[model samples]
Target: MPMTSHRAALQAWLEAMPFRREAVAHLMAAQEAVYLVGGSVRDALLGRHGYDLDVVTEGSAMALGRRLADALRGAFFVMDREHDVARVVVRQGEAHYHVDLAGLRAKEIEGDLRARDFTINAMAVPLRPGLGELLDPTGGLDDLRRRVLRAAYEGAFRDDPVRIIRGVRMAGAFGLHWQPETEALALATVEALRGVSPERLRDELFNILALPSAASALEHPVGQRTLPLILLLDPLDLEGALEPVRLLEQALAGAVWVGAPYGEALEGYLRQTLSVGRERRQLLKLAALHLGCGAAAPQKAEETARHLRLSRREGIHLRLALQALDDPLWRAESEPEPLSIYRYYRQVGEAGVSGALLALWAWPKGSTGERMARRAHRIIAAWFTQKGTLVEPAPLLSGQEIVRKFGLTPGPQIGALLEALREAQAAGQVHDRAEAWHYLKRLIEKGLS
Candidate 1:
């Protein structure tokens, strides 16, 4: 889109947004020259709405944040007292937005713009009513028009190496290609990336993974060159890492149904909420990529997750993806029988869906292997579709029932018997109470139960 058309669209969109006006009014009451700078201005020009608004002013940023928070009945937080930066968080039901205030880092708005990381993020607009003119000192509008991501200056990466990770996210989110100079500068600062804090690295990583085209983001040449530097550890199996992502994309697209209830259910599985962020599905796929779909993947997942300092909940999600690699049905070259699928659901529960997705492409492509993989996929789908009935049926014999019937003590033996009975029910070997008792007698006769 041309700059003229984008400007018109931006104006229409900005005019339609009434939420921002309240906060702007609060800022105006302070009688300071304030401008809506950074991401808010960039997103507005690029036709993106609902992004956090960054406001820069000559007055104390902390005071401005407190004023806005008080007026809007929002929460005020001091982001960086030393740098005169603060934030006001406003919540409306389940939705939330941030309005960040910061003192000018340099003498003028142009200097502040030049000191930013990217050309596309170095634009600003007035927050004062009737004075909403764009202040683009770095030609951010032109770069947005061209769909090219360019560094604001050569030292942008050197200033904060984390920007390289943000670049990967922007590539996937906005479909912007990095300029050669920007890419070169970013690669040159690979060593400096090690100095970045783990929390920042972890946040950027999840943010990148959260994108719909996350696979493309990781597989893209830019990501290929940047990931190793950011990860900063052992050499990853890059091809192995990309395969599960490709499989996940296929599953999400309905090309592969490997055992999720429906395509939408599987999609919802991928979008499942996590303790930290709501990208559990994407993180699980990334985990599968890192730990190849092999028997030893779970151990590798543990080691890698520890090295990355993942949160406790994130570790659980990663383990679930790795656990898929350990499914025994995959060991059988033939299609999994109904009993095998039931047994899998019994063991892994809902997590099996994610595991199956990761393991789908890990299987061989030979004719026999393809058939087995498809069968495994169908079993997963059936487990989701029939979870209440076949997958988790009400066992005819409980632990207490086994203890009472056989005159045995309530011990591990009775628990084992209960498990056996449930397995029998799932395998279709026993149905009603009479058949369950008969099956138990056969197990005792064979000395198995």
Candidate 2:
């Protein structure tokens, strides 16, 4: 659709949202001049709605935010007291709307728009009766129409270097192109990005990783130029890393659980929350990307995490994911069989499979690599079918029972024996407790004790 049509359609559709009316009424009651600003305006004009809403007001932003929070029965937080920026989180069932209230940067809305980082996000709309008209002094609407991301000013990046990261992320997320001038400005100011707060950098990097076509975007010129600079300490070979990320995405794209009992469980496990809003899948893919280059993956991952200020769990997952690539087992020509898979599962639990699969995907797509890939896929599918047995099993014999029956003292031998029993159970050797006891007795009789 043309940009003009999108704008018209979104404008027509905007008034129908129930929250707008409630929000406008509450803000108007406070007698503050509030304008729906930033991404909310941009998204609404692009035919998307009900995401987070950013609002700028002439009066105290925190005061109005508290009022709106109370009116909407939401939780409120003061983001920046000096800037009078506050946030209210409104929950509706499973969905959440974050309404950000900030004092106007300038006396007028146009000046406020000019001070913004990107033109596409500089537009605004009044939060009052009739909702007034769309405010686009910086030609944000035109940029949005062109699918071009333009900076409001050349100094935008210098003012807030985080915008450089955000610019690439936005381009990737929205299929946006950097306007010529904006691209040049960004390139010139790229070095400043390294000095930004680790927390801010981490947030933006995670946003890119969370995207569906993250690798493609990172391979884009802007991302290609900036990403390595951001993680300059341990530069990424993005070309080498794309394959596994693409494969992981493909694996998770469909109704992966169809006809598989553990499909849902496996999907849920991969999607499990890690630290600081990072997911297991994100960290695993990150590990794959880092491991693609060469050795020193663990050190590289640690340095990257430290620079980005990633959470402890995120760092640990990355290190674990690299294990498969680093281990000699996967480097062999022959593919890992069921026993090897069970051994790997015991070695690292869930992360072991994820890492092994990433390694197989990253391999060259020839006869050997194809064989390994197929083997990995089959092993994963079979594991999913028997995930219950793989994850946990009822112990056939207890340590106390072994000690009492065999006259063996508590020591490393006991732990080793139990682990062996568990492995046997995993490999279908021991079914019943009697069978397990018999198996143990045979081992003892064979002088294995």
Candidate 3:
């Protein structure tokens, strides 16, 4: 089905759905007016299916929530008081739908719309019979049609400075431009973001950077400055410090799902690039800096890994990519040895290596770069498939093993030895129990002598 037809069908289905209809009936029967508001209405108009539904009422949100919970047998969580919002979680098959019920303090719908953050989100569709119409008192539909973001009021930013980041996120997500007034509001409110909590600011920053068009949005001078400053609480006055961030954003844009590896990489990159005192920025920077470099240079790769604060596992990936890029032998082969490929699996762990390979393949490149990346990918795949499949190799020596074998007491040395052995095993030096014993024996003997 076409996008438009699908959306229209969904809208019709939602309107007729038992849950929505029941909620509408309950609200009206209780003498309270309700409207299907926010993202659901906005997305339906934009020809998209909204996963979450937000309902606003003119009366008691708690009372409405309990009533709806009883009707639908859904779980009700009265999570907030200041906003008078209650959350209902309803399950359908594997997907869970969230319905938010909010009580309005305003005397009229127009006043309620004016209290919202952005014009596009300020529109509401009434759920009652005579009021079952779009009460877009703020011209949100026009803003949506124009693909522009506008603040609902002058005080909107003052109410919540975090909305500025949200505006950037929306602009990136929908490919919309901010209105001139909205842009000015965002710029002026940039300083007010200092008042927001660090954790909230961190979350908003991650959301913005994780978007596909995040790169394009970050390329905007104002956005670049604003985002970094929000994170660091200090200014980054560089002309183009956001260039790498843009590259990362664009590279990750096509991903169907952004998982742990992506999050780890992004977190590391932001910490280093932003110079924020949050935690382990240097480590994230190291991982990100070596992101696109294929098996190029071993010494440089190791150094880069050390600089970026990568764990032993991450360092192995950097080493493998560097080695592959530098390998004239791999380039010479119509098919590289299974051993060489097994080494790749052994070194980086399969998931990390595979993720690195995909990153290399997706890295912005010309014709030659593309061909090399494709060839490298094929070689890596073939090697893994031909081999008996990579399994996470168990440590040859544990802390207990170290204590038992070496007659060592519990101490930092035991921990340090265990770590060394694990790194050696990952690097493929010690293949078995005997090798591990001998390696430890030799280290002990050398140090004692």
Candidate 4:
């Protein structure tokens, strides 16, 4: 799509609301400068389809947002009560949108544009007599045309250093090289990111890593400053450190990530949703990056998770993936013992899939690396196809049943024997209940002898 005026998109977006566009139209009637501002305008100009709406007006943003929320049958959230900021969250089929409403920080639209972090985001289109009239106080349209990113003002990063993270992510996402001034400002103020709140830093970092071209985003020079401080990795070029991440991406896309074959077995697993709209792919990529931490990789992963406030589920995934790098069970062989596959899933649970993929990426460095990657492929295959034994094998005899049959009580002995029985079952030694009992009896007799 060619870069075009966003007036049609803005119109269609407003019209799509369930309660019609009356709520916003009413607000526009009451407010002198009700406008679609910031990134929404920028994205629309770039021919990007986005549902999130950023609106700024002179009137009470809270009241307007509430009305809009009710109109769209969406949930309303007060972002900043003091600042008269509110958000409306609504979903249209699979697409979700957060329509953020805020009263103008500056008195005029021009001042608001001048105050944003980047030029492209500073533009606004009025929801008035003529939406065609583009507000280009900072020349966002021109910058978009040039495919360049520029800071809106010299103090853009100083006023809120969080913009440093935002700038790099946006720059990479848009594939726009930073203007020299923007790059200098980002480099000079990179250290200021340490002072930013953890939540702010985490959200931005996750957003950065979540980008489709995350490696490209991390390659931004800004990450050289932010990553070591935030991610706790040794000072290294993010491109090289993230090679595993790129490999994982290829594997997820069903490509040759060190010769692993992609097939029906991986389709759904690869498309797993970590939480809400967040994909497991993002955390998987993060795990691959931390794999470069060498001996202290797990510790560094822990610190990074804590620093970023990663969810417990996400933390577990990273630990499992990195751990798989050195695990004995991570063998890639054509026909391996079922015990190894069973033990792997048992040890790592759901993260075994993540671990397998990481192992595929990490174990391709030397002669052993090739062997391990092929083993990782077999593990993935078992996970998808041989799940009856390897992925989720049912126990032949429950611990309660074992206790009843053996005239024993529920204790550690029963638990240990049950695990032994399960392992035997995984080894294909015990199938029926009689076979399971016979195996246990032999173990008991051997132990006594």
Candidate 3 residue 22 C-alpha distance from true site, Å = 6.6
Tell how far residue 376 is off in model 4, in angstroms: 2.2
Clashing residue pairs, backbone N/CA/C < 3 A, model 1: 259-380, 259-381
Q: List the candidates' TM-scores in order.
A: 0.88, 0.91, 0.66, 0.89
lDDT of 3 by residue, 1-449 (tens): 12354235335647755565555566556667787777777876776664577888888888888888777678999978888989888776776777898888488778888899999899887766533667787888888888988898888888898888888888888778989988887787788876777667656665665554555765554576565455342232334434544544444444522443244444343344223333222222223334333233345546544543434654565455445444442344344444444554445443333333434433457855455555555444443333333223466667887788778889888877765665566456777889988888887887731
Worst 10 residues of 1 by lDDT: 230-239
**How do these models rank on lDDT, best leading?**
4, 2, 1, 3
State model 4's lDDT.
0.75
Error of 2 at 353 (Å): 3.5
User: Residue-wise lDDT of candidate 2 within 1-449, one digit each (tens)?
Assistant: 23465446545545667666566668756687888788887777766655477889989998889888999999999999998999999888887778889999998888999999999889887766546778888898888878999999878999998898889888888888889889888888888876787788778888888888787777666776777766654344545666677766765665543766557766776778878478777776677667556677776876787777787766766776676555555666776645566676666666765775676664346777766666656556655665656434568789999989999998887787887777777778888889889888887777666
Ranking by TM-score: 2, 4, 1, 3
In order, the Cα lDDT scores of the candidates are: 0.75, 0.75, 0.61, 0.75
Model 2, runs deviating above 4 Å: 1-17, 234-239, 254-262, 326-335
